[model samples]
Target: MAWYDEAIFYHIYPLGLLGAPKENSYDGVTHRLKELDPWINHIKEIGCNALYIGPLFESVGHGYETTDYRKLDSRLGDNKDLKRFVKKCHDKGIRVILDGVFNHTGRDFFAFKDIKENREKSRYKDWYCNVNFGGNNEYNDGFSYDNWGGFNLLVKLNQRNPEVKDYICDTIRFWVSEFDIDGLRLDAADVLDFDFMKALRAVANEVKPEFWLMGEVIHGDYTRWVNEGTLHSVTNYVMHKALYSGHNDHNYFEIAHTQRWLDGMGGSSGQGFKLYNFVDNHDVERIFTKLSNKAHFTPVHILLYTLPGIPSIYYGSEFAIEGRKEKFSDASLRPALNIKDYKDSVKNNPATKLVAALGKVRSETPELSYGDYKELHLQNRQYAFSRNYDGRSVVVTVNNDDNDCMLTLPAGNSVEYVGALFGERITVNNGCIQVCVKANSGEIWVPAEKENKKKKLVELQTITEAGKISDASENKGASGTKEKSDTHSDINGIEADSHTEREEFEPSYEETSESNPAIEAKMNSMAESKKNSKIDSQLNSEAESRSDSKGNYEEGVIAGLQEAILAIMEKNGYVTDQMRNDVYNNTHHDSLVNWVKSFIR
Candidate 1:
């Protein structure tokens, strides 16, 4: 398999992450790129094996308007600093990909400057698109030219020009030879010429074996760009939208439909292409701010890692930081942060621990990397799916509601499943397995027999016995023998069964009678320990959720609802500036709900 197929990517916008100046001053090198060394170690600690950081080339602003393709941005550092950084990443076994902004160049680029200085007589007049000396533009430079998103500052390139293609291809060769980079994330690739992408793929393959080429394609059929001659993958924006919206709207059907569409696009056997999957990126709002319910964080990431695609985590998102796009600026979405500030809280931070645990799970489980997708269960508030590979199956279930949910899913021929996160062993009866997923939580269940090899049999047996004890306790009657004390204490000094009131959705199991006090006492102790451990885990997770949800929950819900409505309207081409204003300005709960209902209809 190619390295990207199993790669867990950690995306870093270097200019934002390192606090480099937004505009290139053309001053001396600042060596700001070296600050990423700690982040590199942190990525490894979180189980990321690949890094996608870029737009490092010299740029006039935001790193996309390229001023010099051959040199590192002066605000970041010299080329030597990049070389050292890439070497450091490689030494730690992490693959690196840089942003390829080939479609456009800043107005200050040498070729563009030449066009401006020499007019029609310039030798590089053909380097840009639609360069007409007779007409003038917004800048009134005595010429007209095509640009990106109606921004004249970003001059579009003429990819059909042989010199331009050769220059870009040669730059790729330089990046490979000089920095030893592994791949490129082609910026604005949706508008790029197909012939140009084909040429890029050819050059990439020629320079290095298994060199990956992923594109920034927001819409349209991905097959057009991800075919053998073009690119290995494109940004999976369809799923990116579904992830946050599905959870916010309490609709799993949206997510399931998107998965089906992806499966259909990939053809029968499985998801043929490992499209890059992400919750949030530098261009959009952070997932923390996008999600209305903070508890859904775990489930969102659960799907990100377990779904059929290459998973990626945007920088600083793992810490549950909130960032939303302002009316005219995305500066909030890409804030500068230091890892050292979070060092003391890493262990206590629920999102951090969960991300790290998921990373470890993704790295260790081969099924997650190569498994075929299967939907075992689906509901508005709960979902279950399985990844099967080489006759081994790993099941993943998630609950998005504010209360616990009991999901009974098809297990096929599997007899049992072991929880990959907490080592909880669940028995399958009559080709079905029932799992009690906590509110806003998820579980990764590996077939018990397969998981057994990785874990000690004794420990597995102990856990199974404890599960049985807990199951029996659930069905015990009020007439049953009373315990010596009202509460049971565990090793961590946590109290279990402190309240007689059971949760509304707690499952009931068959009861059993134990005659021997010694044996029953031991089993009861083990069960209490298990229960206390779960309680401790829940407490930590809830603490994190509370910390993240410090703002008004009602306001978040209203904002999330408004965004969802706008997104749907935009998708349907019915959105207007007036509609957006109406949605944002009217904060009445009933009005927003009615608007959402109308859009849904």
Candidate 2:
């Protein structure tokens, strides 16, 4: 298999991540790209095996309007800096791919400048599209030229020109020989000429074995671009939209349908093509900002990694940072962030921990990378699917509702399955396994025989308390109404037997002492406290006193206090409905401060 087929990508917008200047001043090399050395280590620590960072070529602004395709942007550094960065990533066992902005160029590009200087006599007049000397543009260059998105500052390239194709092909060769990069992400590929892409693919194959070509295609059938000859994959925007909206709307069918449609298009193997899947990218609002309910962060990302595609996590998204787009500014979506500021909090952030767990699950499970897609169960708020290959399977189930959900899924002939995230083992009885998924959470259940191979997975002994199996046959829908049918079905809508006997299993906390000493100590303390019935009364008395002393606090102070309280609660997994109410509804500044202190203690 190709490296991309088994890759977990971490995307970085270097210009923004390094806090480079918005416009290139043509200054000397800055060595800003060297700052990414720590980020490269961070990426490996998070279990991401590939890095997709760029628009590193010289640009006028935002790293997209290319000025010199052959040179690194002065705001970032010289080409040598990039070479060392790529070498560092390779040393860390990470593959690198750069953004290939071939569809357009900035007004300051050498060829465009030549066009503006010589007018009709310039040899590079044909390099750009629709150059007419008779008409004028907003810049009053005494000529008109086709521009990308009607922005005259971005001159469109003439892909039909042979000279342009050769120049771009030669640039790719130079990049391969100098930087030794692995792949390229074609920008605005939907509008790129197919002939140019074919030529580019030919050059890619000639330059390096298994060199990948992915495109930024938002709409239409992705197969048009990700076939045998043109490109390997396109951004899975179809599923990207469905992933967030489906959770927000409590509709799993939307995502299920997209998965089935794309899989069918890839033919019977279902692994014939793999699109690049992501929750958010540099062009869109961060997933944290787009999600209406913050709790769905876990489930949404669970689907991103487990689904039948190459998964990617945009920079800063693992920490649940929020960013949204303004009318004409994308600055918010691409803010500068330093890993040092988030290092201590990375392990405490639930999303980051979950991402690390999912990365482990994806890396260790071979079925997830090469297996065929099959839907085993689907509902408005809950869904289950399995990836099977050569008699091995990994089942994934996600719940978006506010209450726990029990999913009974077909297990074929497998005797048992173990949870990859928490290492909870479930026996397959009567050709099925019923697993309880916590609210706003998900699980990856792998075949029992495969568990030994995944020794590095996070083994949470306390998750069973949160995932106790309950009777979901009469579970209510998101609207609080009971559903009539509870049978598992395949993607074809054929129902399986739902008459299996319900098994009652108590929550177990046996192995916590070895896996997690901190949790074991907390559990022991809770148990000892239960021996004293007077402890509850004493806590109630203290709470009443804190509530009684309400003080007038400014809104900003209250907001800051609330943020601190939540941060503490998040680290301890103590966030609950009552805690939210106490934090948000209480007006006493001293009470909030006490809560923070209590959490810290």
Candidate 3:
């Protein structure tokens, strides 16, 4: 398995982290990059092993529109300074992942500029998209070219050109060979060509077989870019929105459905394909602003860590640093911060302690990394799920409601459970465990005693035999136990009489006598159904990855809805915040689309 499978990421917008100006300085200062050395311990303390540093390359502005691929951005440091910084990170047992903005380049990029100056005669004219000398240019360069997302300064590259592809591949190889980086987060990967992405993956694998390639895919089916020929993973924007919306709307069903649908999309392992999950990044508002209540932070962190993905925390988020993205500027979202700044902000904040504790829990738990997900129960403001691996299970329960809620676990083996957050001991009786989760809080429960290896072997054999013997196997056992239905004895060679007491534990179902073999048999049948459900869940999860057409259709519907909203806004002559909120909080996308269609008609 790749190290990223178990790794937790800490994302840093380097230019913002180092206090570099938004515009290029070309000052050639290296000292700002070194300030990260002191923060290495701070990163490790929160259980993050991977550092995803965004855009340290030479750029004209914001590091997205790159001018040079070979040199470091002069505003931050030189090549040597980066090498030293990377060395320090490696020495401290932290892996580095750089932001690869290969989709576009700045207008000042040498090759693009050459095409502009030389026009039709330039040999590098084909390096850019739609370079035409036939029309007047936006920048008055005597030619027109395609810019990324209508941004004239950010020129899109033509990867179809052999020379351009070769240049990008060589740049990737140079970074791997020189800095020994662990991974690359491809910027604007949604618009990037699939063939180019495959080639990029092959090149990165050739340099380092385990070199992770993640994409910045905001919409569409994630499996389109995360399958075998493309990237290792993509940003889990679906879950990101579901997460905050579930809290904001006080509807856990929204997120629960998303989790159930996507959790099994991770191939045969059903690990959900290791999405790069985050609550906030440089592109969005901070979690503090996203969440309606501050108390929901703990439960949100709990869900983030326990969900099937490689979770990440934006810089300063662990300490509740809040920032919102303005309409036309990202300056508020990505701010420069020193150690003193983080130190002062973290003081007296419970968010750090809560996030750190949750991070450590995720790091130590195997189920969180590679287990199959099965949502047990869900309501508008409460949810429960299980992560089971090799017969061991971890059950998670969350109550987003303002009042305490009691959850009755499905009937199963009588076992003990320990809360991952507080180490509180809980005992199960008659295959059922009931617990009350506090309002706006959650708990992670792990089996206190490991299952018996021999018993597991027996259960597997018995289940397989049941597939063939059908009712005979169950009948034979029933016949033997029928006479002693009133006696407490071994059923199927497993203990059935050990009961743990808790006055606080309330049973949702009616109590049955310990001597009732009929009740025991019924419970055992339910257990078998639960076991079959696990197998079905695994199959469903694998099938989920292959069902991309449905996702594509859904995306089309969403696009249509957005267009309808825009048209309506244009016609109405006013757009209110309530209308925006309605659009956002509408979990039933198709219903909203139909409503808009009717209103427009």
Candidate 4:
């Protein structure tokens, strides 16, 4: 597995993580990473390996406005305090990654202040963007220099300006060399040019070669940033969009679209995972708000963790934080550390159980964590996919339907349970079993019985090819179902798609397709995420049933074992061919017709 492949990151807005009362929060607006150690420790107990802290460099409130490049924000704590926090986290095997906002700095940032006090005398006068602090004092409000779209408080740092580059580069070096930080997350990466980010990467890697650099670049394909070597990964925004879009401007089609994007990213690299996926972050409304409810957030959390790349949990999310466009300092949005409060809500709660279970499973099943992800069964929100490394395989299915879902496991009884991180033994009564998951819930299966190892790679290839074909028909409004499979077992009932899955996670309100008041709109603002990765649709629909039992079984069989052919041919990685395959009606390998007994009750 890639170092970050199985990594689960937890983000904490330092100033917002205090266990003590708000009166004892930040003296002013500064980072209190240490002051929040008690809370951070709690996150570790629950299992998080990385901490993505917002700007820690000296700055005003929000820490986005940096004053000193190397010093810590005095109001909250000091450099030593930060070191203590980092040391504690490292002691727990957690990596320390800071939010690197190189694109801009606080007005008091050395260069800007130097220019502010000594108009032309400062050598770095050109370093700030559009400063017209003259007689009319048009910028008397402050240095009018902006950050992208006129964010005066955060003056854009001119990375194109070489000297500006040296200072920022040195700052990163100081943090890594002196503190031994594990990674750097570049903020507003889209605004920064290629060279600037490349420079930052060079410096950070020099300090620690495996040091990760995740860009906050939204929109367009962020794969360019990773493939071009400017970053190790960017946020998985497509799935993020799916998490919030719900069934409004959304449907199973759009959600699966995001999964397709994720598969594409996974195929591109067998090393150095290139995506940091999450459901809710510091800036957006908490995941609970966007989901149908806290119950639904469970599936979304599973979606974030198991999907490709490194998964992250924003601080307070483990406790079910909820709100929309909350101000940075508001206690309601940034509540006190309260994992205990949520512990009950998640106890016996299937969704939370699934999330906790799968996160643990992801750690053990390296294939699921680090292997190639290919869709196997996707339809009606019962999205099923497999992650295979060498001969090891883990299959995952997310059932978004209200009715009990009976997923067929390819006529086999030799699958072992990897444990869903929490509960280990998934004792199915027989080869035929029934699963009852709330809408947006998932379960993963591992091959307990070994097949021909030589066919291992072949198996992966077949699944991938089948996935591509399925993906093509996804949004086209088609869904798949199990026909009379000779081997159909009780547990191996027909799987389903999102539309079908929605039966379980259905909204409280009726289909006012035009309006979605039923969805409890929390993030009424905007999502900073872009379409970086998406889901695929090789699945069948739970949305509808076949005309007859015989028709379902007749059509459910895989024809001719062509999966082997596709597997062999797919290795060449014909991305172009995969796209073209979607346009045509490709058939999958049909299996034995009368092998197993039906499971659906």
Cα-based lDDT at residue 141, candidate 3 = 69
lDDT of each: 0.74, 0.74, 0.68, 0.53
**lDDT (Cα, tens digit) per residue for candidate 2, span 574-593:** 23454456456654565555
Name the runs in model 2 displaced over 4 angstroms. 267-269, 450-601
Q: How accurate is candidate 1 locally (lDDT)?
A: 0.74
Q: Which ten residues in a row have the lowest lDDT in candidate 3?
A: 458-467
* Candidate structures ordered by TM-score, highest first: 2, 1, 3, 4
Tens-digit lDDT string for candidate 3 (414-503): 378877666666778777778888788888887775542112110000000000112211212212321111000111001111111110
Residue-pair clashes per candidate: 0, 0, 1, 61
Positional deviation of 453 in candidate 4, in angstroms? 21
For candidate 2, what is the TM-score?
A: 0.76
Superior by lDDT: candidate 2 or candidate 4? 2
> Candidate 3, 371: how far from true, in Å?
0.3
Better of 1 and 3 by TM-score: 1
Q: Report the Cα lDDT for residue 449, model 1.
A: 71
